[model samples]
Target: MTNKLTVKIWRGKEQGDFVSYEVPRLASQTVLDVVTYVQRNLEPSLGYRFACRVGMCGSCAMTVNGVARWTCRTHVSKVVGEGQLEIAPLANLPVVKDLVTDMSEFFDKWARAKGSFKGKRTRADDFEPVKPDSRERKAADAGVECIGCGVCYASCDVVSSRPDYLGPAALNRAWTLVNDVRDTQQRERLRAVAGDAGCHACHTQGSCTVHCPKQISPTAGIAGLKRVVGRAAVRGRL
Candidate 1:
């Protein structure tokens, strides 16, 4: 309810420190609005990335008050404790500059997890009939809505400790693909996600599930992956 809010924003690359800024407070103002004000009115050189201002793009996500959140959807009134805000880049990723982060490694692990779909049928083939209510379909439906916002990845502690570990998003995607009956590369996908750097590396700490803006539970998906991958390995299918 104050006229202005004290915001501390991170200002450099890998090695950076928080810099304080005073931003005018408005009703229902979002954290993205604060960062934008700092950039457009106070400091033109400030760097950040945002595509769709609405919640769909998930590009406006950042760490607000030590939690990963979609800045566009986060209301200042909800998180600005003590009339102050602390903004930082998403954790566990390489910081590019200012508020932007390098997502190369994040997507790289997606490929390493074999997250892409591979089917035996050609485009000429008729659409494969899929049962929506079936167990696999239901399971796959739960995790297919990911927009690669990296919130879950940023929230995951495993990614912070073991850099080689495949983060929650990629593993969750792999679980989705693995459950798809239309996908024929289950064996390879299982193989790709089996080792320490893959599904097995997850600590199941649930940080990803807790912070996901989409309400998707990557922890549950990773659990399902563990079961399937373990069965595959035991059956010599991995």
Candidate 2:
């Protein structure tokens, strides 16, 4: 391990390039720590986004050496190669500036996939009893922990190939809702995720599953969506 690391950081919006800087290496340093040092000590004008540096927020994700990762949890010793680091905004999204990529499109796709749960119960209705061990509940439990991190979206190769694709995170959310017995919009949600730009568009390359920091298998969710949608299509319900 060297005393200094060559840090090359993206310096502008979508049209800019990488700018090099020398950052003093420290013990147990994370990639976010390195970026913070550059912004605070070397270049005060540098722009980036981070909250809850402990990795709970999932807002500190960025592309490091061509791979999307949570910078806060990425140790410097693990990523530094030849005492060098390359940091940039997450891919497949519009860059706001420096390490901040515009997340509007990512969330927009979530909406398009009907990611939100719609229930039939009103405020005055009695509480619905749900069994934790039921199959539906088990399926829902498999994917209910998504944090909207966008790491899977950034790592999905299908999104890069087909810009209109709804992407993995949105489809994953829809899958969870599909298994929610309380959710009244299963048919509509299935319709939303079924067409050319939806679940069928996924080639199942599994990059989204491979890169998700949360270990959420979006590929599995997509496969479930495919089975549901295919059944609906066969029955002329889709």
Question: What lDDT score belongs to each candidate, Candidate 1 first?
Answer: 0.93, 0.93
Lowest lDDT block of 10, candidate 1: 229-238
After superposition, the stretches of candidate 1 with alpha carbons farther than 4 Å from their true spots are none
| RMSD vs true structure, all candidates | 1.0, 1.1
Cα lDDT tens digits, model 2, 126-173, are 988889999889888888888988899999889998999999999999
| lDDT tens readout by residue for model 1, 1-238 | 5598999999999998999999999998999999999999998988899989899988888999999999999999999899899999999999999999999999999999998999888999999999999999999999999999999999988888899999999999999999899998888888888887988888888999999999999999999999998887788886
Error of 2 at 139 (Å): 1.2
Clashing pairs in 2: none
What TM-scores do the predictions have? Answer: 0.98, 0.97
Q: Which stretches of candidate 2 lie over 4 Å from their true place?
A: none
